[model samples]
Target: MPQQSAEALTSQQKTTSRRPAGTLYRGREGMWSWVLHRITGVAIFFFLLVHILDTALVRVSPEAYNAVIESYKTPIMGLGEAALVAAIVFHAFNGLRIILIDFWNAKYQKVMFYVVIGLWVVTMLGFLPRHLYNVFNN
Candidate 1:
């Protein structure tokens, strides 16, 4: 038998005292924001892979790139284009907020989060109408 130090005992107690994983979900705003940040990050990674492939098409031939561009001109694809832009915008702003919280004293993190959200909304409102107009008008 080995003697466990007080620090080790306290750490073990903390780990075992937690609720089960399934029951741990509190559904708070911060939790939701964290989850969304991760989801958007993965989506952006996959989109980047596809974007790189499409960009490579231009090296193959102008016709190859033009074909890809022409396919993206559909109204349905336009909606997706708008969503892609939105995800990019949200991900970038949220990433900055995360960096600020991680590096700075961020005492008012919840209020800062609301500010991030407000900025996101304003950015979307400013861009979406113009994007949608370009989408349908083309």
Candidate 2:
């Protein structure tokens, strides 16, 4: 068997590493939406875990629970809560879009994806005003 020359090995490595990632991610909306969907899902899961633990604190003591809940009423926390609602909205609608693509029809994926985004936007617009009003007014 012949050993490969250093120059030959280096040339092969250059060719192989040229494609760090293929045309798979050419700024397509669908690809980005899928990525965001996964991110929001993971975030929601962690938030739910913390939320459950906080709710269970009522069992420990109602004052502690109220304290924790009250702590979430500040401007920063209100903004955080708004972002949470946005994440929840996006994740929920995207999940339904995914279901339609997987079970109902795959051909209308692009259109459905846009529809999902529109619905998410409408939902956020409807909720954001009320949520901010309550948060700020309280």
Candidate 3:
């Protein structure tokens, strides 16, 4: 308070002039990727739990298991299965990308993220039509 030096004043001004940090993620690609990864992981975990429980029903009662399996054959469930596939594909590819990032310590994460999206789109394109046909035509 007695005497502020020029450097100190300039630095204080710089700090005050800058915008404040906003959201936790700042709405960046990395944030979205991180969010999607966690969401998909939780989703996959729940799906696996349900699948295991339903499959275990076979040991208890075959008719109950068959009924549950048949209930999944509807068009609505077909669409849900497609969404599950999309989540799995994204989660898997992003996991590989994350592994590569950790292994090589590269700076191409943004590009790799786009690559993951591209691959997911291509894979879904290749898989969806046939899967949907089978789902609906049956």
RMSD of each: 5.3, 4.6, 3.7
**Rank order (by TM-score, best first):** 3, 1, 2
Report the lDDT tens digits of candidate 1 across residue range 56-107: 9998998999999898999998998888878888889888888988999667
lDDT of 1 at 134: 94
* Top candidate by lDDT: 3
- Report how far off residue 51 is in candidate 2 (Å): 0.6
Could you tell me the lDDT of residue 126 within candidate 1? 98
Q: Higher-lDDT candidate among 1 and 2? A: 2
lDDT of 1: 0.84
Residue 116 shift from truth in candidate 1, angstroms:
1.2
What's the TM-score of every candidate structure?
0.75, 0.74, 0.82
Clashing pairs in 3: none
After superposition, the stretches of candidate 2 with alpha carbons farther than 4 Å from their true spots are 1-27
* Model 3 CA RMSD to the hidden true structure, in angstroms: 3.7
True lDDT of residue 130, candidate 1: 93
